[model samples]
Target: MKKLICSLLIALPLTTHASSTLRCDSGLISLQDSTSIVSSKCGEPISREFVGYREVQDEYGFYNEVAVEEWAYGPRNGMFQFLRFEGNRLIKIDSKRGR
Candidate 1:
C-alpha cells in the first residue's frame, strides 16, 4: 500500500504535465508565428485569457512592456493545448491530458 501511494505521488505530476500538441493544416506551425497567423490557420481558440503585461529586456538593454495571453484549445477527445503568446507572437504551446 505504501509503495502504491508513493508511486501515485510520483506519477501525478507527470500525468498533469502532459499537454496536447498543436497540429496545423500543414503539419505543426512554426515558432514565432504571429497570433493573427495562428488564428487564421487554427481558427479561434476555444478559450482566451489575458495574462496581463510583462517587462522584458531587449538586446540593447532596453525594457519594454509586452502583453501576454494564454489561449486554450479543445480537448476534442484528446489533449487540451494551451498557447502562450507574448505581444502578437506565439511563445510556447503546452498540452494537458483530458479528463
Candidate 2:
C-alpha cells in the first residue's frame, strides 16, 4: 500500500503537466515577433522574412528570463517563434505554423 501511494504521488505532477500542454497552432502568432511566439510552443523556425533576433536573460533563483528569435521552415510546415521575456524570465509563449 505504501508503494502504491508513493507511486501515485510521484505520478500526479507528471500527469498534470502532460494534460496542461496545449498543442502547436493553438495560440497567438505574429510575424513581427516570431521568436516569442515559437518559443512558447516549442517551435523551431527554419526561415523568416526578418532573418533573426538576439535574446538575453538574467538569472533569478528558481526562475529565468530568456529571449530567442528564430524561424523554421519545413517541406509543408514552415513556422515562426518569437520569444518573450519577463524581467529576464520567459513566462509566456505563442506560435504560428504554415499549413
Candidate 3:
C-alpha cells in the first residue's frame, strides 16, 4: 500500500497539463494576452473560429456578453495548439499530437 501511494504521488506531476503560454516566432503568448498581440507574434493561426459568446460579470455586477473564439496553430513538430479567447483576451491554451 505504501509503495502504491508513493508511485501515485510520483506520477501525479508527470501527468499532462494544459499550457498557459505558447512560444511563437516573435515572442511568447500567454493567458490574458490581447488578440492583437497573439496575432502579431504567432502570425495568424491555421484557422480562426467563433465559438460563441460568453456572459461575464463586471466588478459593478453588470453582465456583458463577450465573444468567444478559438484559434488553431500547427502541426508544428507533429503537435497542434488550440487557443481560446474570451472577448479580446486569451483564456486557455491546449496542445495535442496529430494523428
Q: For candidate 1, which ten residues in a row score worst on lDDT?
A: 4-13
Candidate 1 local lDDT, 1-99, one digit each (tens) = 345434334433345443234686545655688888888878877777778999989899999999998777656556666688897888888766553
Query: What tens digits encode model 3's per-residue C-alpha lDDT throughout 1-99?
Result: 345434333534333348989999999999999999999999978777787899999899999999999887776886677789998999999876654
Off by over 4 Å in 2: 1-76
RMSD in Å for candidate 1, one decimal?
A: 8.5
For all predictions, the C-alpha RMSD in Å is 8.5, 15.6, 10.5
Clashing residue pairs in candidate 1 (N, C-alpha, C atoms within 3 angstroms):
19-95, 19-96, 20-95, 20-96
TM-score of each: 0.73, 0.24, 0.80
Provide backbone clash counts, one per model. Answer: 4, 20, 0
Q: Sort by lDDT, best first: what order?
A: 3, 1, 2
Best-performing candidate as measured by lDDT = 3
TM-score of 3: 0.80
**Alpha-carbon local distance difference test for all models:** 0.70, 0.37, 0.81
- Report residue 87 deviation for candidate 3 (angstroms): 0.5
lDDT of 2 by residue, 1-99 (tens): 345434333433322111112345547443343345545654554433232344434354344333342233232334323234333334333334433
